[model samples]
Each structure stands twice: as structure tokens, then as C-alpha cells.
Target chain A: MTLLHTIYLIAITAEAMSGAIMGMRRGMDLFGICMLGTVTALGGGTARDILLGHYPVGWIANPEYLSFTIGAAIVTAMIARHMHHLRQIFLLVDGLGLVAFTVIGCGVGLEMEAHPSIVVLAGVITGIFGGLLRDILCNQVPLVMQRELYATVALFTGVFYVGMLWLEVNSSLATLLALGSGFLFRVLAMTFGWKLPDFQGKEIRGLD
Target chain B: MTLLHTIYLIAITAEAMSGAIMGMRRGMDLFGICMLGTVTALGGGTARDILLGHYPVGWIANPEYLSFTIGAAIVTAMIARHMHHLRQIFLLVDGLGLVAFTVIGCGVGLEMEAHPSIVVLAGVITGIFGGLLRDILCNQVPLVMQRELYATVALFTGVFYVGMLWLEVNSSLATLLALGSGFLFRVLAMTFGWKLPDFQGKEIRGLD
Candidate 1:
């Protein structure tokens, strides 16, 4: 398999495990955990494909991906208590996954000949929407919308990758540069507790 | 426009108004309210089309629908304080919308030649997922998963509509029967306070 493909598989497995943990915390049954995990792993790509009119969405075309996500969820459900110590590792893997997913999404958008802006947006959507859907299923405000620089990382990665392509960089070179820079950016953001500005939502009123 | 088309216009407007009200109660700003309203009106069909790999989703194909929903939300924001008196009318129109959405969804499924079960599922998805998405964006567990017979009405409408088509009933007659019966079912369920049995979720544990 290609390097990107290998990373994609690993990223989806990590994403599924995190989703399973969230579902478990919410006291979901095994079925709910599996469903949530699958959605978390694949929902972004599904949403991107639908919005872009890409056919036979990723998981549907490759049902093997379902096996990976469902298996990861079930395994996580079985050994969740022991997972607390792995939190650091999980975060690192998750960040890597976010970067990988963004680059991969940009590739799809480029293949579709979308505008550069739309290509970047597709990348961001693919990177963050899975978590967004997972938070929705868990019945909470999406952290990406309210928390640290998570979505910003995706946006940066997409724009950088697209810019490299526009500059005639080799596709493989662009992918590696985007992934390496994006992952580093995410790591630094998390380590330093970086965050986007929070709007003073309280000042905005009257609709109610 | 056809009767079904007319009801659809009214339905989206009503759905958008309700979504705007919810956003207002959540203290969202004007932009947030408009977005929530549009998603509440159009999200179900968008979701259904994506799942079915149907291209050119309804709203994307007819941008005019956005004007209807956005317009309804803006108007509702300006006059929501006086809406309490119209609760009864709102509920009735909402019920009618639910049934109409279900039937129209089934029509699309039929056009795609999906299996009967999938067709019915598409109908249900198109009927309720808008509200499910609205609730998600507002950060709440979806009421359809917990409340009185709402999704069940969609399920019943879909099944009845599909069954009539199978029996070679005229399409227009089948549409009328399904819409009338589904609306009556919803109204009666509401009037009598009918509800599905809630599973005791507290006893479910261990995965966490």
C-alpha cells in the first residue's frame, strides 16, 4: 500500500477508538458504540463525498473500512479502563490522523477539479466533521467549533498543500510537506495550549 | 404548483420558524439563527440524498428553497414573542409537514429504484433528520429518539405509501391517502399524548 493509504488506515482506527470511548462514557450499548465509532471514522469523508457529488462513497466502495472501524471500537470498549494511560499516545495519533485526513481530502477535491478555495474547504470538512458528528451523537456542542486550534490546523494544512500544488510542487512532495508541517503545528498548538479567540456571545442578543 | 408542492413550501417555512425559535432560545446570534433554520428545513433531504448517492441534492438543485427558509427564519426572529398564541396552528402545520416530507422522500426513493425497505428508510430519514440535525447543531439529544411517536409517524407514512404503490394504487390517490392518514395519526398521537416506551438507560453500563 502507498504511504498515504497506510496512514489513512491507521488514522481511521485511531478515530474509531476515540469515538468508542466517547460512546462508552455516554453509556451507549455495544451497537451504539459501533455505530458511533463508524460514524466518527467515516462521516467526514461521507459528508465530503455527498457535498462534492462523488459517487460510491469511500466506505461504501470499500466495505473493508467498516471492519477496521467496528473492530477498533469493539476492542476499545473491551479495554477502555486500561486506555487511560495511553491518552498521550492517543492524542498524538489523533493529530496525525487529522493531518492525514486533510491532505487526503484535498487530493480528492483536486481530482474533482474544484476551485482552490473549495478544495481547501473540502479538506477542512474531511478533517473535522467526523468529530463534529461524533459530538452531535454524544449530544454536546462540537469542541472544534468552540475549543482550541483543531480546525485551524486543518485549514492551514489544506491551504499550504493547495499552495504547494499551485507552485508546481510534486504531488508526493506536497503531501509529505503538508503532513509533516500540519502534524507539527497541531502538536505545538496542543503543547502550548493555543486557542482561537472566543467571541463574546453574551453581548449578542435580541433574537430570543 | 401541485398540492404536495404547495404543502412542501408551507412545511419548510414552518420548520424554519421552529428552528429559528430554538436557536433564539439557545442565545445564538442572527447569523446562527438563519443557519440553524436553513439546516432544519433542508438537512434531512441533504442527508438522504447523500446516503442514497443521489446527485444534485434538492436544495442545491433549487436554490430558491434557501430563500424560503432564510426568509421564514428572519421573519420569525422579528416576531417570535407573539408566536406562543399560535402553538396549536404551528403543531398542526408541523404534522402536515412531517407527512408531506415522508411522501415526497418516498417518491425520490422510488425514482432511484431502491429496495422497498431502503425506500421506506429514505422516507423516514428525509422526514425527521432535519430536526435531528437541528437538535445536534443546538447541542441536544434529538427529540425524535426520545419523544412521542414522531419518527413512528414517518415510518408509518412511508410503509403505507409504499404498500399502496405496490398494490398499483394511482400515484396521486396514494399520495393523498398517505398524507391524510399520517397527519391524522400524528394529530391523534399528540392529542392523546401517546408515546413509545422509553428504555431504562441507567441500567445499561460497563462499556464506560
Candidate 2:
């Protein structure tokens, strides 16, 4: 398997585990946990494919991905209490997955011959929308919309990768550089508690 | 426009108004209100088309729908407080829209030659997912998943419509019959405060 493909598999597994944890916290049943985990791991790609008119969406074409996500979710659900100690490791893996997802999404957008702007957007969508969907299902405001530089990392990775290709950089090298830089960016942002600005007075009424 | 098409226009407008009101209540800004309204109006079809791998989604294919939704949202945002008096009318139109959306979705599924079950599912998805998505964006458990017989109405409409087609009923007649019956079912359900059964104890912990 290609390096990116390997990372993709690992990332999905991590994403699924995290999603399962969230579902468990919500006291969801087994079916709900599995469904939420699958959506969290694959919803971004599904959304991207649908928007770009890319048919036979990734998981549909490769059903094995479902196995990975569902299996990871079940495993997580069974051992979640013991897994609390792995929080640091989970965060690291999740961050890596975020960046990797961004690069892979950029690859798909490029293959579709989308405009550079759209290509970058596809990447961001693929990177963050899974979590967005998960949060939606959990009945909570999406953290990406209100929290740290999560989406910003995806946006940066996408733009950086697209820019490198535009500059005639080798594709493999560009992917590696983008993933590396983006992961580092995410790590630093988390370590430093970086956050986007929020509306100062959240009660700015009237426009509603 | 055909009868179904005309109803769709009115339905989307009504749906958008309802969505805008929800966003306004959430203290969302003008842009958020418009977006929420649009998503609430169009999200179901967008979701159905994506799942079925149908290209050029409804809104993408006919950008005019966006104008209808956005225009309705903007108007709603401006006069929302006064809209409380129109609750009964709004619910009536929303119910009609729900049934129309189901029939319309079944038509697309039939066009694609999906299995009857999948066709019915598509109809249900197209009928309810808009509201599901709206509730998600507003950060709440989807009422369709928790409350009255809303999704059941879509399910009933789809099955009724598909069964008529199977019996070789004329298409227009089937559409009218399905719409009429589904709308009636919804109205009666509402008038009588019918609801789906919820789990006896919402605190069924441990599956987590």
C-alpha cells in the first residue's frame, strides 16, 4: 500500500475511535455508536464526493473502510474506560489524521480538475466536516466552528499543497511537506491553546 | 409549472421561513439565518441526491431554488416576531411540503431505477433530512428523531406513492393521491398530538 493510503487507514481508525467515545458519552446504543463512528470517519469524504459529483463515494467503492471504522468503534466502546489514559496519544493521532485527510482531499480535488480555490475548499471540507457531522449528531455546536485553529490548519495545508503543485513541486514531495507542516501547525496550536476570534459580545441582537 | 412543481416552490418558502425563525431564536446573525434557512429548505434533497450518486444536485441544477429559499429567509428574518400568528398556516404548508418532497423524491428514485425499498428510503430521506440538517446546525436533537410522527409521515407517503405506481396507477393520479393522503395524515396527527414511542427511560446507560 502507498504511504498515504496506510496513513489514511490509521487516521480513519483513530477518527472512528474518537467518534465512538463521543457516542458512548451520549449513552448511545451499539447501533448508534457504530453509525456515529462511521459518519465521523467518512462523512467528510462523502460530503466532498457528493458536492463534486464524484460517484461511487470512497466508502461505497471500498466497503472495507466500513469494516475498519465499525471495528474500531466497537473496540473503543468496549474499552473506553481504560482508554482514558491514552488521551494524549489519541489527540496526536487525531491531529495527524486531520492533516492527512486534508492532503488526500486535495488529491481528489486535483484529480477532478477543480479550480484551485475549489480544490482547497474540498480539502477543508474533507478535513473538518466529519467532525462537524459528528457534533451535529451528538446535538452540540461544532467545535471547529467555535474552537481552536482546527479548520485553519486544514485550510493552510490545502493552500500549501495546492501552491506547491502550482510551483511544479514533485507531487509526493508536496504531499509529504504539506502533511508534515500541517501536523506541526496543529500540534503547536494545541500546545499553545491557539484560537480564532469570537464575536466579543455574543448577544449582538437585532439581525436575527 | 406542474402541480407538484408549484407546491415545491411554496414548500421551500415555508420551510425557509421556519428555518429562519429557528435561527433567529438561536441568536444567529443575518448570514447565519439565511444559511440555516437555505439548508433547512434544501438539505434533504441534497442529501438524497448525494446518497444515490445523482449528479448535479437539485439546487445546483436549478439555482433558482436558492433564490426562493434565500429570499424567503431574508423576508422571514425581517418580520419573524409577527409570524407567530401564522403558526397554523406555516404548519399546514410545511406538512404539504413534506408530502410533496416525498413524492418528488420517489419520482427521482424511480427515474434512477433504484429498488423499491431504496426508492421509498430516498423519498423519506428527501422529505425529512432538511429538517434533520436544520436541527443539527442549530445544535439540537433532531425533532424528527425524537418527536411526533414526522418521519413516519414521509415513510407512509413514500410507501403509498410507490404502491400506487406498482399498481399501474397513472403517475399524476398517484402523485395527487399520495399528496392528499400524506397531508391529511400529517394534519390529523398534529391535531391529535400524535407521537412516536420514545424509549421508556431516556437514561438507558451502559451501552455507552
Candidate 3:
């Protein structure tokens, strides 16, 4: 496998395990755990392909990818306590994975000769949709909507990647730019406890 | 417009309004109201089309459908209190809408010449995915997953539609069966507090 493929697997494994972890926190049954985990790992790519009308979504093309996420979920189930101890490492890895997802997402959009608007949209969707799926399953407001610098990082990464490609930059260099900037933005935000502006929830309880 | 088209518009409008109502309950901003409402109105069809690789998703095919849902959301924002008193009516309408979504979903799947399994999957997806979107946005375990008879009804509706087609029944009669049974199932379940068995959530807050 290429370096990119290796990173992609790393990202998917980290994401799926995190999703399984969320399922555990929510006291979800085994079925819920596996479902959410798989969704979390593959949801972004699925959304992107569907949005672009790209047939045979990524995991569908390589069903083995599905097995990887399932394995990650099972491993998480078995090593929850140990993983918790390594949470800091996972955070760094997740940040890296987000960057990887953005670069790959931009490539997919560009490959399709999508509109400039769609390129950026695809990148952001790919970067954040998985965590959105996880948060939805866990019954929380999507972290990307409120988390500092996350979606912004994805947007900026998309812009950078697309712009570089537009300027005839080679694929490797553009990916590196996208990857480095997104990773830095994410890690910096997480380190500094940064947050986005959020709507104040009123908990109205008014009937519809 | 065909009967299916008419019912679909009704379904989307009601689902969007309900989503807007949920946004109100959550004290979401106007943006949130519009976002969740649109998701609730279109999410099921989007999921169904995506899974089936149907191109130019429903809202994309006719942007007016999206506008209708947005309009319903805005209207709900203005008249949320008035609508609260009509909760019973809304509930009944929602039930009917579920039936409408199911038949349309099944038809789409059939048009694709999908596998027997895919036909039913499409039906359930079209029927309940929007509600799932709404509940997720509202930060609740999907009511469809836990509530009795909801997904089950959608499953049966799809099964009935696909089975009739498989048996070479006339299309109109098959649709009628799918719609009637799904509608009755939903209404009866709502009225009688029918529910699917669900895993108990312990609120663990474990090592996510």
C-alpha cells in the first residue's frame, strides 16, 4: 500500500474505535456499537460519494475496509480501559486523521471535476461528517458545529489544496500543504482549549 | 402531479415542521431551525437515494421541494405556539407521512431493479430516516429505533410492497396495500403506545 493508503487505514481505525468508545459511554448494545463504529469510520466518504453521485462508495469498493472498522470496534471493546490511558495519543492521531481525510476528500472532489464550491464542501463534509455521525448516535450536538477550529481547519485545508492544484502544484505537495495546515490548526485548537461561538439552548419544552 | 408526488409533498412539509418544532424545543437559532428542518424533511429520501446510488437526489431534482420544507420551518417558527395545541393532529399527520415516504421509497428501489433486500431497505430508509435525523439533532436516541412499531411498520410496508411486486400484483394495488398497512400500523402504534424493544441506556459516561 502507498503511504496515503496506510494513513487512510490509520484514520479509519482510529475513528471506528472512537465511535465504539462513544457507544460504550452511551450504554449502547453491541449492535449499536458496531453500527455506530462502522458509520463513524465510513460515513464521511459515503456522504461525499453520494453527494457527488460517485458510484460504489469507497468501503463498498473495498469491503475489507468495512472489516477493518469492525475489527477496530471489537478491539476497542476489549481494551477500553487501556485505550483511555492512551487518550492523549488518540487525540493527536485523530487530529492527524482529520487532516488526512481533508486531503483525500479534496482529491476526490477534484477528480470528479466538481465545482470549486463542491471541492471545499466535499472536504469539509469528509473531514467532519463521521464525527457528526458519532455525535448523532451518542445524542450530543455535533462537535464540529461547536468545537473550535475543526470545520474551519477543514475549509482552509480544502481551499489550500484546491488552490494549489489550480496553480498546477503537484498532487503530493498539495496534499502535504493540506495535511500540515489542518493538523496544526487542530492540534493548536485542542491544546489551547479553543471553542467556536455557540447558540444558547433554551430548552423550551414547547409542544410542536 | 401524481398521487405519490402529492403525498410526498405533504410528508416533507409535515416532517419539516416537526423538525422546526424540535429546534424550538432545543432553543436552536434560526440557522439550526432551517438546517434540522431541511434534514428532517429530506434526510430519509437522501439516505435512500444515496444507498441505492440514485442520482440527482430528490431535492436536487426539484429544488422547490427543499424550499417547501424551508417554508414550513419558517412558518413553524412563527406559529410554534399555535401548532403546539394541535399536537394530536400533528401526530396523526406524521403517521400518514411515514406511510407516504415508505411507498415512494419502495417505488424508487423497485425502479432500480434492486435486490429484494434492497427494496425493503429502501422503504424503511425512506420512512424513518428523516425522523432519525430530527431526533439526532434534538439530542435523543432515535425515537424510531426505540419506539414500538415505527421501523417495524416501515419494514413491513417495504416487504408488502416488494412482495406484491414479486408476486406480479398490479402496481397500483401493491402501492395501496403498502400505504394502507403502513399508515394503519403507525396510527395504531401511536395510539396504543406500541414500541420496539430497545437496549436500556445506563447513562454510563464511560471512557469515550
Candidate 4:
């Protein structure tokens, strides 16, 4: 397989595992677990492809990814009895997944002739959207809003990668640096419980 | 304003109300409330635009909608104390909101020269995506997944609308019929506790 195809496979694997862990942690039934897993696996890449004007959708194109996600979900459900402190694993895998997705998203955006800001934004979206879907399914505020410097890290890495491309840097070196930056930032934040400044405005009311 | 634009504005208003209710019920802060309202109002249109390959994103294209969403959210938060039985109100407004969005989405898809099947899918997406976003923000399974008939109703109505257009029927009449059909089906389902069959294939271990 080509490098891009290999990356896609790894990306799908990460997505499937992330989804499975989320389902097991949530104590959801098999159906709900599979649903959550599928959503997590496809959410970010789906958004990316749609925004990039790709037809048939990525998951729809590669139905095997969907099947893999479902299989992961079922296995996780069976092992739910023994999964302890799995949140840490989910977070780690999730961060790596984000890094992988961001790199690919930025690379694809650049290849598609997108503007720099938009390319970076695309990377951020690819990095964060799956977790957003996971959080929503698990009935929590999206980590994108409440957590550590997740989006900032993704955005920064995207800028770095795009800048390297602009400067005619080695593609492999730029990709490795960008991915490492995001992954390291996320791991450190997880270890230290780093948080963004919370908005101090009066609490809003009347939302359902 | 063009009829299409007017319909879209009304749909946004309904969406804002839905978000405000979600936030007030969830006890989110002001920024959170505004975020919910914006997502509710713009999420469907944004998704449609993205899927149809439109650029700049509709909400990003016209920032006024964002301001309006925030303003509406603030006002709703203020008046929530006096609101009673907001659940029923949500059901009604959300149902209507779905119908309005379906029409607007199909119209845009038609304008884009999309195939009829794609147009129907667009309508269904617009009808449900905002609510899906709202539910996700609130940490709930999306209404569409939990209620299978939800998006299906919109899809059928969209197909009917597009079929009418294909037969050279009046555009306004076709739109109205489509909207009404979707709205009535949803309202009836909500009132009747309608749902699709549940997954009952016995939880097989590692059965992905």
C-alpha cells in the first residue's frame, strides 16, 4: 500500500479503538456501544471529506472501516468487565488519533489548494471532531470546549506543518515534527491536568 | 427578502429557541448557552453547505446570524424562570424546526443541481443535523438514531417534493406539501411515542 493508504488504515484502527473504549466506559448496551463506536470512527474523517467536496464519503467508500469499528466495539463490550482505569488509555489513544488525523487533514487541504488558515482549521476539525462526537454520545460537554489546550495544540501543529511545506522543508521531517508536537503537548497536558481559562461570565440559563 | 431566505430565517429562529431551552435546562454558562444556540441555529445549514461543497460556511459567511443567535440565547435565559412545561414547547418547536429546515435544505440542493436522491438526503440531513448537534452538546443520543422514523419522514417528504418538481408542479406548493408532510409525521410520532425496532440480536461476545 502507498503511504497515504497505510496512514488511512492506521487512522481507522485508532478510531475503532477509541470508539470501543468510549462505549465500554459508558456502560452502554451492545447496540448503543456499536453506534457510538461507528460515530467516533467516522465522524472526523466524514466531516473532512464532506468539507473537501469528496463524494460517497470516506467511511461509505471503505465499508471495511465501519465493520472494523463494529468489531472493535463488540470486543470491547465483552471485555467491559475487566476494563479498569480505561479512561487513561482512551485519552492516550485519542490524542494519537488526533495527531494522525490532523497531519493528514492539513496535507490533504494543502494539496487541494486551500488557504493556510482554512487548512489549519481543517486539521483542527479532523483532530477534534471525533472526540466531540464521542463526548456527545457519552452525554458530556465536548472535551473540545472544557479540556486542556487540545484545539490550540492541534491548530499550532497544523500551522507548523503548513509552514514547513511553504518553506520547502522535507515532507517526512515536517510530518513527523508536527505529529510529535501535538502528541507531546496532549500527553503533558493529560499528565498535569492542564486546563484552559474558563469563561468567567455569568452562567446562562433556560437551555433545554 | 426572498421566500427562501425568509423561510431559512424562521428556521433559524426556531433553532435558537431549541438551543436556548437546552442550555437553560442544562445550567450552562453564558458562553455555553450562546454556543448551543449558535450550533442549533447554524449547524444544519452549515452541514448542508459543507456536504454540498459550498465555501466560507453559511454561519461564517454571515456573522450576523451568530450575533442573532447569541442575542436570542441571552433573552431566553432571562425569561426561563417564567417558562412552564418547556418540554412540550420544545417538542412542538423542534418538530416545526425540522420541517422548515427540510424545505430549505432541499431548495438549496435543487439550486445546486443535485440529483433527487441527494436532494432528499440533504433535506433529511438539514432537518436532523441541528437537533443532532443540540443533543450531542447536551450529552444525549441524537433523536434521529434513537427514533428511526425521524429522518426517514423527512427523506420521504423530500422525495415527494422533488418528484413534484420533476413533474413541473408549482415550486411553492411542492415545498409547502413537503414541509407539512414532514412536520405532521414528526409531531404525530412524538405524540404517539413511535419508534423503530430495537437491536435484539443477542449480545454476542466479540461479534463485530
lDDT of 2 by residue, A44-162 (tens): 99988878898789999999999999999999989999998999999999999999999999888888877786688679889998998999888776667556788889989999999
Question: Comparing 1 and 4 by lDDT, which wins?
Answer: 1
The residue ranges of model 2 lying beyond 4 angstroms of the native Cα positions read A1-46, A55-139, A143-208, B202-208
- Clashes within 3 Å, all models in order: 0, 0, 2, 15
Tell me the TM-score of candidate 1's A chain. 0.98
Q: Which regions of candidate 4 fall more than 4 Å away from where they truly are?
A: A1-11, A25-27, A85-90, A200-202, A205-208, B1-41, B50-110, B113-132, B139-208
- Which residue pairs clash in candidate 3? B148-B195, B148-B196
- Lowest summed lDDT across 10 adjacent residues in model 2 chain A is found at A199-208
True contacts kept of each: 0.14, 0.13, 0.34, 0.22
Give the per-residue Cα lDDT of candidate 3 at B99: 80
Docking class of 4: incorrect
Per-residue lDDT of B1-208 in model 2, one digit per residue for the tens?
2999999999999999898777777665555566678888999999899889887678756767878998998888667767777888888999999999999999889989999999999999999999998888878778898888899999999999999999999989999999999999999999999998878675777665
lDDT of 4 by residue, A53-105 (tens): 65677778878888777887787777756755566666676677777788888
Chain A TM-score relative to the true structure, per candidate: 0.98, 0.98, 0.92, 0.84
Isolated chain B TM-score per model: 0.98, 0.98, 0.92, 0.87
lDDT of 3 at A86: 82
Ranking by DockQ: 3, 4, 1, 2
